[model samples]
Target: MKKPLVLIVDDEPDICELLEITLNRMDIQTYTAENIRTAKALLQQKHFELCLTDMKLPDGNGLDLIDTIQASPNPIPVAVITAHGNMDTAILAMKKGAFDFISKPVDLAVLRQLINSALKLSDPVVTKERRIRHELLGESLSMWEIRSKIDKVARSQAPVLISGESGSGKELVARLIHQQSSRSDHSFVAINCGAIPLELMESEFFGHKRGSFTGAVTEKKGLFQAAEGGTLFLDEVADLPLPLQVKLLRAIQEKKIRPIGEHQEIPVDIRLLSATHRNLAEMVQTGSFRQDLFYRINVIDLHIPPLRDRKADIPALTEHILVKLSAVNKIRPPALSKTALAALQQYHFPGNVRELENILERALALYDGKIIEYDDLNLPISTHNKLNCPEYAPDFGSLEDYLEKIERKAIILALKENKRDKAAAAKQLGLSVRSFSYRLKKLNLDS
Candidate 1:
């Protein structure tokens, strides 16, 4: 793997040398410049994962670099170095698109942490790509159903609400919707409602004009405006505060936004998609979520199924992840033994698809290019024990009753795992078309 590069811009030679030495020890390559012009030239010549610049420069202010970086084709995260009393300027730097700012006489440990975090944020596309490459590996009925739903929902502009346990591919669904929409030609902007700090929430969603607040030194476009003519994906929408929820509702309803410290509303032509792992209806009932907003955003809903419910898809999913991971790691693919596959199928994945991917990754790390045996798969003992337990099992008076109970449980689990794929469930259980129909009807589990 290539080492991440850092660009340090400061007039002080000693500081530059110190940072270069410190970062090089951590295996990070460093580039140093004394002024804004040299820094910009270097930035243009080569891409740096991150940039740290002093607020005071000989030719120009470091805040000016923020605008330049944002305008660049490949924007490098920039952090402002400010004096103790220059906190106001540092805050201004952040508002102007600086990833973060540090006070002068920087603590090496704190600076290192900030640099590492910023590098990760600077290249989210890579992480997103890695995630997608890991998904879509299942061949079960539930997997096919999810694929079908993605296809169906992608064809519409209706607002979609995706609900699932964490790691169940809610964001992946959102991305698929954006990719298939009429606005696919435009940007697909995603924001985590719960992750934004309460104080910065407004600025993040509605943006701010220059001089809007203590740190607002320049006009900035929020995610909504940034996603104009495209799709705006609001992840964890249920986490949005009640007050901000009203503002978001107005934006969705009116198709306009008024930036902070600005009088006029900017008209936005965009498709809105929101996802939440939380139960919005429950939150609404508890008076935590606004009923009006929920109704507005949930014009269409998509629920992702957990992995355990779609056990039939386990074989395909395992093979898919293994192939993808092999390609990425540039290694020969390992085979999954039948016993190993059975082990995976029997396990209850509380984290859903995400958990399965993680387990597979661990298996790959230990496989040594050999077939993954049951012993090679280090699954929890509890999972295997549950599969063998008979004492607490169901007792049916007749074969019909036993089959009925099994069918009901399978259907319910399928719906939950495949995010509710009727056809997939029927296929997985090896039932005839009419037989599955009758079972669903008898059980009153048909949706």
Candidate 2:
């Protein structure tokens, strides 16, 4: 069998000689180049499985080489050799489509690992068929751009910061990236950083030794250890307290972690992906968040557009949600009338997709007819007022009876919208908790 070939590009002769000897020892063939001009000449001559280039070359920087390689019809996997502690340049190279990066005075173990990963990318077995495609489910221009970026970033090991409002599916974007990456076969551990208690955050993130502290009855694996050789998605990462941020930065940069009560540090291989609805830049300016950690994690940003921006996709999203709701309830999925969909599209969804799903679930359960009309949807009165009928429609019978019916309908709508939480519904309707409870009983809606 022919040996796998690699191109080593660097201005220093010592670095080139070192890399050539290492590759030869690993049964790989190497073609060496001293400058960008020679590297381009060698690249033009024949195919190579991988290209390792230094960031500061005599002719040009590593970014220029990355662009040249990425623009080719069949781009080979490339890694950058950056000077130690210069993560900004490393991040720029990764953004420009470098497969991965290593720092100067490279450890042989790390170099071998990087080379092995790049070789896997060049393998024919790791083809498009192997990629697991998850549905993002939208056809808007912004959605198209998001999908394109996801595909591009999935091929790299760069840390991605997903920014969007709550319920906009930032974690879903992270999952899609992991599923489509070379790390798909491993665990994708996701944790909401804010959800963990402040007292136990360290143990939760870095694991704990048995009997290390109170309530430590058994040894526990932290999220980092659990996601070994895979992805760790820190949802709501902005909520991480300042103290833990420093430790997290070290673990990420060094690729090592020391669990609570442990004397030795364990090397962990994890692809870090994080998300936040809060503004990190603002938080950094205010000293509430670590600026260094912010820069480290925000190497690339993926923005998820709010649901209101993609109103054109509401019909399809509504249909998909209805189908799932119907399957769970064992009923035929109801279709949305044009007016009802228009109401949904017009109402600014403060809660984004999550709010849309809740609205559909409530409608699916409560509406009796197969076609959901405008009146059937329990949207805010502002939307319902456009084509409202219950108010203006005349009643020939007792006036008191009509008024009672209207009040009953309004109260019932509030309860459903608030998920049967009487207190919240009362607040929405400008009533005290006691008054709301009395009204629910009076209308016989408490049943």
Model 1 whole-model lDDT (C-alpha atoms)? 0.75
Residue-level lDDT of model 2, residues 22-73, one tens digit each, is 9899899999998888988899998999999998989888788889999999
Worst 10 residues of 1 by lDDT: 386-395
Q: What ranges in model 1 sit over 4 Å off?
A: 1-137, 381-447
Relative to the true structure, candidate 1 reaches a TM of 0.56
Give residue 439's lDDT in candidate 2 (0 to 100).
Answer: 82
**Candidate 2 residue pairs in backbone clash:** none
Q: Clashes in candidate 2: how many? A: 0
Residue 14, model 2: lDDT of 94
Task: Please give each candidate's TM-score.
Answer: 0.56, 0.82
- The prediction achieving the highest lDDT against the true structure is 2
